[model samples]
Target: MQTGEHPQLQQQLMVQNSSGSLSFNSNLSKEDEEMSRSALSNFRAKEEEIERKKMEVREKVQAQLGRVEEETKRLATIREELEGLADPMRKEVALVRKKIDAVNKELKPLGHTCQKKEKEYKDALEAFNDKNKEKVQLITKLMELVSESERLRLKKLEELSKNIDSLQ
Candidate 1:
């Protein structure tokens, strides 16, 4: 065989040459031809069976592939639907977060105002307590002055009565 000759062509050529030689030499009988024909028929039947089985398997594979594609499309649609539903919720969440931030910003000043008011209230309470202490001291001084005046008036009255008796 030449280097470039295909292996399959070489095998066909060899088979043809051998069969020609056998027929020319009368060594291949009619019974041998019949047996070869039967074997070829059997081989053809087997090849047809294999082809049928291959076709059935191919069809089954195609059906399964179609089902898989449908399933994939269904799942994709479901994912899209879920995402669509979530869009509003996602926006609502963002809005709620913004509102919370706004409320927090407003509360900061209120907290400071509360602290200032608490301080003012404490200062006022301290002033009131100091004034109450001063009032208690003034009331004590007033009671002492009243007692001294009463004692002076009684002594004056006794001196006047003795003078009247001497005159009589």
Candidate 2:
């Protein structure tokens, strides 16, 4: 009845004869053996079930890992192929950019030249306009002088005719 002692051991201790000799109880031993056998059988069955479940989970994890590795390899191959294809286009893009830069450099000087030519044309046009204004003024002055000379010549002709009549 003390704490921590097995029930079978307590029972065996109580079954001692008054002569203080230990008496063997075959019935109790057989019952204890049968209970031990039943407990051992249940434990073994549970252990086997746990082992089978562990194996099943391990197999599933391994299969998933294999598939993941295969997908990763496929993606890597695709990336490599895309990079390979892009290399030529990248070079072509660089070449086109260089050509555009060269054209722009050439156009810079042409733009300046065009601006210079346009300024020269404007200056020449201004000079031509000034000369045309001067010509118009000169033509007006010439016409006025011609009218005055004609009046003087007419007055002198009238005076000479009077002098000739007096001499006749």
TM-scores of the candidates in the order shown: 0.44, 0.43
Off by over 4 Å in 2: 1-86, 158-168
Tell me the lDDT of candidate 1. Answer: 0.76
Q: For candidate 1, write residues 1-168 as lDDT tens digits.
A: 333433443344346545764222254356544554554566568879999999999999999999999999999999999999999899889999999999999999999999999999999999999999999898888888777777787788778888888899
- lDDT values, one for every candidate: 0.76, 0.78
Among these predictions, the greatest TM-score belongs to 1
lDDT of 2 by residue, 24-99 (tens): 5465566555554554566568879999999999999999999999999999999999999999899999999999
Winning candidate number (lDDT): 2
| Residue pairs whose backbone atoms clash in candidate 2 | none
Q: What is the C-alpha RMSD of each candidate to the true structure, in Å?
A: 12.2, 13.1
